[model samples]
Structures are given as C-alpha cells and as structure tokens.
Target: MEALRAEHLDKRYGADETEVWALRDIGLVLRAGEIVALLGPSGAGKSTLIKVLGLVTRADHGDLWMNGERVLDDGAPVADVGELRRSHLGFVFQKANLIPFLSARQNVEIACEIGERFAPRARADELLDYLGVGHRGDALPNTLSGGEQQRVAIARALANAPSLILADEPTAALDKERGRAVMELFRRVAHEQGTAVRVVTHDHR
Candidate 1:
C-alpha cells in the first residue's frame, strides 16, 4: 500500500535578495513495509524534505497524500494536520529525546495515550518487549545505554502502530555498531510491521 506521496514540493526561505530555495520540485513516494534512507551531505535539504513529509513544516507548493487521502495542497493543509499526524505518523530524532523524569515504559505510554490507543500501559509494555527493551522498561533514559535508549525511543515511536515513521539522523549519536543495529531494527520494523520508514542520514553504509 502507498503510505505517503508528495509531488512538486517546494520550500523557500526569506524573500527577494536573501531568498533561498531549500527544496524545489521534490517528489517522493513511500510504500508500506519499506525502509528508505535519505542520504546527503549538510545543507542538502534532506532534513527539509523530512520536515515537509512529516508535516512539521509546510511546503511552499505541493500535493501530499497519506493512505490515499489528500492532506496537503499548494502549501495548505486540507485536513486536520494534528489529527492526521497523531493517527498515522511517528517520529524519531538524533537523540533519544525521552523525558528525563519518565521511565522507558512511561515514555512509550505517553505516546500511546496521545495516540488514543486502548490500554496504553499494556501497549507500551508490549512494544518495549517487541523492541527487546522490556527488561529496561522501568529504567530511566539517562541510566540506559545508548543503544538501549534508542530502542526505547523506537518502541515509543511504534506505540501508535503508525503507518509511516520519519527518523532524522536517528543513529547519529550512536557508536558504529549501535548505529548499524538501529538501522537494522528499522528494517525489521518496516518489514515485519508493514510500516513505511524514511531515515535521513549522512551514513552511506
């Protein structure tokens, strides 16, 4: 199934003399059960593309569809962006970004709650277990190893069973081994759970 599609996307910053076209005529399609890596150097508009596709930033011009529904048109939103995001999209960043005070399970639980899933706590635990982080569920983020923290973040991202996940430099902070593991984890999640994943990174390996 097509999880996401965007065509003729354009994004610009500033006006007149200082104007910069961050992205122009960019197009993309993502299907379920696929893991796509957006590899580029710095200032290549990779993150801009992610932000646009994730709906965190509007494209100056484009048409965007998710799950066969048209959500954006000509830089404007046709649907409730917030509701669509909560229901269909997940995100991971360079850092784990888990709340400091919340335990691993609670971090995932809050996401489940936001996604309005039933039995949030149970769902959180299930995801943690599925991601191989159940044993660390009660541990704080700071206490967990880097790889473990990233696993928890991935579990939280899966809490809503989202159709698409957008990860921006998700492994940039990890060591080589842990980074590869996280990339492999994304592949597993995409294939096994039928989620579409887009990861932005400088790593070409």
Candidate 2:
C-alpha cells in the first residue's frame, strides 16, 4: 500500500515579480515499508518539499494524499495540518534537538505522550533497545554520543507509529560509518514498523 502520494505539487513565494518557485509540478509516491532518499543541492527545494509533505508548511498548489485522504488540495488546506502532523507523520532534522534536562527515554516518550499514540515510555525503551541505544535510556543528551543522539531522535520519531516518516539531512552530522548506520536504521524501522521513510540529503554519502 502507498503511505504517501503527492500529485502535481507546486509552490511559490512572493508576488508575481519577486515570486520564487520552490517546487514545480512535483509528484511522488511512497509505498509502505520503503526507504527512499531525496538528493539535491542547496536551493533545490528539497527542504521545502519535505516541509510541505510533512504538513509543517502548506503547499501553494497541488494535492497531498496521506493513507489515501486528501489533506491538501489545489493550494488550499483541507485538514488540520497540526493535527495531521501529530497523528500520521514524523520528522527528524539535522540535529537530535533533544531536551537538555530529559533523559533518552524521556525525550522519546514525550512525543508519544503529546500525540495520540498508545505507547509512551514503554515504546520509547522498546524502540531505543531495538535501535541499540537501550543502554543509555537514562543518559542525558549531553552524555550520549552523536550516533546515540541520532538513534534517540529516530526512536522519538517512531514513538507515534506514524505511517510516514520524513527526515531532513538526518545523517549530515555523522561520519561515514555512523551516517550509514543511521540510514540503515531508517530502513529497518520502515520495514519492521511498516512505515514509509523519506529522507532529504545533499549527498548520498
């Protein structure tokens, strides 16, 4: 089944003269249990596309169907983006951005607690264990390594069991080995959790 489907998506900024086309008639379909990476140079609208698809930002034109529902249509909003983002989508950025005071498990559990997801801390520890970070459940973000921090971030993204996971430059901060590990973890989560993963990166490296 397709987890996300975007059709003829177009987005622009500013008025006619100063307008900039961020995305132009872009179309994409992501199947369940698939891990796809988006590669492009700076100013290529990669981040813009992720934001629109993730429902963090609205698309100026086109439609986005998540799990077969029309959330966005013809540059207009049809559903509550905030609610949709919370219930059906997950996101990760360049940094882990964990709460300084919160431990690993707490950081992961916080998302599930706020969202409608059933599991909270239990799910967090489970995911952290699966991601190979269970040993650091009580460790603060400052105490964890870079890889561990990203792993915690990934676990947090999966806390809600979202059908679609969108990440922006997720592995940018890690070295080659750690970066590949993070990418592979995304694949594992997509396949194991039956979620669709879409990542935006400047380089496949």
Candidate 3:
C-alpha cells in the first residue's frame, strides 16, 4: 500500500527578481516496508523537498496523500497538521536533538507519552532495546557517543509507531562506519517494522 504520495510539488523562495526555485514539478511515492534515499547536490532542493513532504513547510503547488488520505491539496492545509504529524509521521534531523537534561530513556519516554496509548516508559525501554541502546537508557544524551545518541533519537522517533519516517541528513555528522550503521538501522527498522522510511542525505551509501 502507499504510505506517502506527493504529486507536482513546487516550491520557490523570494520575489521575482531574486527568486529561487527550490523544487519544481517534483513527485514521490513510497510504499509500506520500503526504504528510499534522496540524494542531490547542495542547491538541489533535497531538504526543501523533504520539508514539504514532511509537512514542516508547504509546497507552492501539489497534492499529498498519506496512507491513502489526502493531506495536502494545492497549498491547502490538511486536518490538524500537528495532530496528523504526531499520529502518523516520525522525523529525525541531522542532530539527535534530545533534551539535554533527560536520560536516553526519558527522552524517548516523553515522545511515547505524546501520541501513544501504552505505558510510556515500557514502550520507551522496548524501543531503546530494539535499537540496541538498552544499556544506555539511563545515560544522559551528553554521555553517549554520536552513534549512540543517534540510536536514542531513532528509538524516540519509533516510540509513536508512525507509519512513515522522514530523516534529514541523519548520518551527516558521523564517520563513515557509524554513518553506515545508522543507515543500516533505518533499513532494518523499515523492513522489520513495516514502516516506510525516507532519508535525505548527500552520502552515496
């Protein structure tokens, strides 16, 4: 089934004179249990496209459907964007962006509390364990290494059991080995959990 679909997406910045067309007539379709990577050059609109699809930014012209529901139509907003994001989408940024004062477990636990129905802490631990960061659950974000921190972030993203996962430059900061590991983690999560994953990155791997 289609997890996400965007058609004829167009985005521009600035007025006519200094205008920049970040994306033009772009289209994307993702299916459940799929892993896809978006690659482009610095000015290739990769980030802009991800933001548009992730609903962080609106597209100038397009239609978007998620899980067979029309969410965006010709720049119009969908039903409660925040609510839809919380219930159906998961996002990971270049940084882990975990709350500094919270432990890895707590970081994920808070996300679980937002849109989940089960015991938050239990679900958080389960996710952390599943992501191979179970032992670091009690450690603060600062205490963990880059890869470990990203693992915690992934666990947090998975806490809500979102149908689609959007990651922007998720492995940019890590070394080649750690970056590959993180990419592999995304692949595993998509196939094993039946979630569609889209990653925007410059890395060819």
Candidate 4:
C-alpha cells in the first residue's frame, strides 16, 4: 500500500518581489516497506521537502495522503494535526535530540508512553535491542558516542511503531562507517517492520 503521497506541493517565503520558493510543485510517493533516499546539495530544498512531509511546515499548495487517508488538501491540514503526527509519523533529525535528563531507555520510554499502546518499558527495551543499543539503555545521552546517540534516537522514533519514518540529515554527524550503518539500519527497519522510510541527505556516496 502507499504509505505517503504528496502532490503539487509548493512552499514559498518572502513577498512577491523577494519571494524565495523552497518547494515548487513537488510530488513524491512512498510505499510500505520501502526505503528511499533523497539526495541533493545545499539549498536544494531537501530539508524543505522533509519538513513538508513531516508536517512541520505547511506547503503553500498541495495534497497529502498518509496511509491512503487525506491529511492535507489545498494547503489545509486536518483538524488535529498533532494527533495525526504523533500517531502515524516518526521523525529523526541531523542531531540526536534526546532529553538531557533522560537515559537512553527513558528517552524511548516516553515516546511509547505518549503513544499509549504497549508497555513503555518493555517496548523501549525491545526497540533499543532492535536498534542494537540495548546495552546502552541505562546510559545517559552524554555518555553515548555520536553513533550510539543516533541509534538511541532511532529507537525513540520507533517507539510508537509508526507507519512512516522521515529522517533529515540523520547521519551528518557520524563518520562514514557509522553513517553507512545507520542507513542500513533504516533499510532493515523498513523491510523487517513494514515501515516506509525516507531519508534526506547530502552524502553523494
């Protein structure tokens, strides 16, 4: 099934004279259990596209379908955007934005609790183990390496068992090897969990 589809997405900034168009009639389709990479240089609207897909930034004009449901049409969003996002979409960014006071496990636990489905502790542990970061569950974010932190972040993103995952520059902080590992992790998550994954990146390799 189609996980997400965006049609005629347009995002602009500034006035008519100094208008900066970030996304111009952009369209994309992602299917369940598929992993797709969006590669572009700086200022190429990669981030803009991610923001639009993730529902952080509204497109000036477009239609959005999530899991076959119309969530956006003609630049208008559904009534409960927050609920829709929290329940169906997961996002990872360039930095591992973990809560400083929360341990790796706690970080993931909070997300599960918010989702209000499975037991937070058990689900958190399961996700950490799935992401290969179970051993670091009790450790604080500060104690983990860049790669480890990113792994924890991924675990947290998966806490809700979302149907779609959007990552923007998720590997920008890691070394080539670690970055490749994370990319592979996304692929595995998509195929194994039946989640659709879209990653925005500048790494040409």
Candidate 1 on 5-106: residue-level lDDT in tens? 999999999999999899999988999999999899988998899899889998999999999999998889999999988989999999999999999999
Cα lDDT computed for each candidate against the true fold = 0.92, 0.91, 0.91, 0.92
Better of 2 and 3 by lDDT: 3
Cα error of candidate 4 at position 3, Å:
0.4
Kindly give the number of clashing pairs for every candidate.
Answer: 0, 0, 0, 0
Clashing pairs in 2: none
What range of 10 consecutive residues in model 2 has the weakest lDDT sum? 116-125
lDDT of 3 at 88: 85
Name the 10 consecutive residues with the lowest summed lDDT in model 4. Answer: 78-87
Checking candidate 3 for backbone clashes, the offending pairs are none
Off by over 4 Å in 4: none
Work out candidate 2's RMSD over C-alphas: 1.2
lDDT of 1 at 21: 95
TM-score of 2: 0.96
TM-score of each: 0.98, 0.96, 0.97, 0.98
